[model samples]
Target: MRTKPVSDEKSQRKRFLSGNGFVPFILRRLLTSVLLVFGVTFISFSITQLVPGDPVAANLGQSAYSDPKIVAAFKVQFGLDKPVPVQYVKYVSKLLHGDLGISLSSKRPVLDDLKEYFPATLEIALVAVFLALVVGLLLGIISAVTRDRLPDQIIRVFSLTGVSMPAFWTALTAFYLFFFVLGWAPGTGRLAPGADPPPTVTGLYTVDSLIAGDFSTFKQAVAYLLLPAIVLAIYAIGVLTRFTRASMLEILGNDYVRAARAKGLPEITVIRRHVLRPALLSIITVAGVAFSSLLAGSVLVENVFSWPGLGQYAYRAAVGLDLPGIMGVSMVVATVYITMNLIVDILYRVIDPQMRDAS
Candidate 1:
């Protein structure tokens, strides 16, 4: 066959990529995500407006709630004196400029506080999701392999109990047993008393500490992290286990699977190469959902452990009735969720060629 010219090949490649609608599909989703973020921001702002108490009061405290001049200045200072539409316009404008407004409680920028707090949540939530995937997949694989037997029965019941039980109750019980009685983990918070966080290189204590050669802080951070990560992971673990088991069962009985088995391939190789790899499509879907839940913040677990993550920060904002802070947290959460969803949608294209073809 004759070789195509370089310019012709480039033109053909561009045409092929543009013809698929793949790039356009992603761009469309991005546009949709931007619209969704706007909607979420509007809803969050409106809901915060519905919250009783003035932003001035939240900013100045009980002492200044009755001071007219102070309240007026505060309102103007943050543009709260305007009508709701005006305020929303200003808020969105500030957001476009990377300003999340000032935290009424701390008198700091909401964006600054979020940057400080979010990484902590991400660190622990990442650990939780990792643990969930590892443990859940192991149990699921074993259950599928030993289908209808005692192991499967036990795993089913365990998953049921986990899915049924509330995370708060589990967290409290675990805290009492592990921290109070056994004293295995740190009592509360992300660091030991009087211990400064290591240099904030990445704001994740474990990683930052390790990077700075601060093993002591790194170890303490891990210890403080483990209990909460475990508690937060329980629900995800149950869900992943069930999904994995179901998908594995479905895959195990396929004609190709049976043929592979009949070909006398090693059980491990067949399971790893043919069964697990393909069945992972379903697992990845479940994992993305689970990870979203984790990253959304385990409110109860964060509060119980006194972890200074987004969940704890949000809970404090709620209790304090800090409208700006509340709005900031809501926007952060919506952004995280939408971003994760976009990532998962893209992954669907990679995992299944049929999905790309259909798109």
Candidate 2:
């Protein structure tokens, strides 16, 4: 047959790969996520307002029956005397300007405190996530590949136990067993009591210490980080392992996998090349969603371990009914969740070309 010009063939292939329209699909999802974040923030703010006792009273360490004059003055100072609608408008406006308001308990700007603590939380969370992904995926693959074997049973049981245990309980247990009983690590806090916290560049002690060329501080921070990170990773490992196993099982049943087997490809190659890559798309999606929960859930673990992180800050703010602080934490979490979901959406396109075309 007469061959088409090279340019014409390339154009045909491009059209085929492009598939149908995608712009509207991507734009719509992005816009929806933005709206969801806004809605969540608004609801959280409204709920914070409805809780009994004025934030000023909470900060002032007074009962609800405090002097009317004192209460009035407190409200006025914090702008809480204004109508609810007015307050909401101000809050939304300030949020638009990236002003998270002042924390009543700390008497500092909420954003400033958040900036101070966020890096520690992010570091712990990142390390925990990395651990979870590596350990969970490996165990899951091994379990699936060695189905009906001892290793698979052990992994499944471990995942179940991890999922069933609460984070606080796990953290406390780990603290007692590892720190108190075995004397293997420090009991709590990000570093030893006498060790001076390195001067903050990023507020993450590990990174800041390394940047300052203080390896001792960095090592101590890492040692302190292990218990809490492991506690956080346990549940994540459970979730990811289940997801990976399910994805892998489905991928293994596909015709391409059978074809690879028929072609006498090694089992490892068939799995590593044909099965694992496809399975990971789902694993990555689950991991992203699970990561959002990790930060939010770390409050209990941080408290148990005495880690100086955003989770601890959030716990204090919530117990004290600090409106600015609670709102600040909520907004930060909402923003992170939205941002992560967006990144995952984009990554889906990269990992699965069909997703891009369908979009």
Candidate 2: segments with Cα more than 4 A from true spot: 1-33, 63-65
- Per-candidate TM-score against the hidden true structure: 0.89, 0.89
lDDT of each: 0.86, 0.86
Q: Show pairs that collide, candidate 1.
A: none
- Predicted structure 2: clash tally: 1
- Model 2, range 1-359, lDDT digits (tens) per residue? 33456567778766544434456456666778879878987899889978887566567745643778877877787788899889888988888898888887898999999998888899889899999989999988998888779988898899889888888889889889998899997778889988899898888888899999999999999999988899999999998887888899989999999999999999999999999989988898999988899997799999988788899999999988888899999988998898888888777777887765553
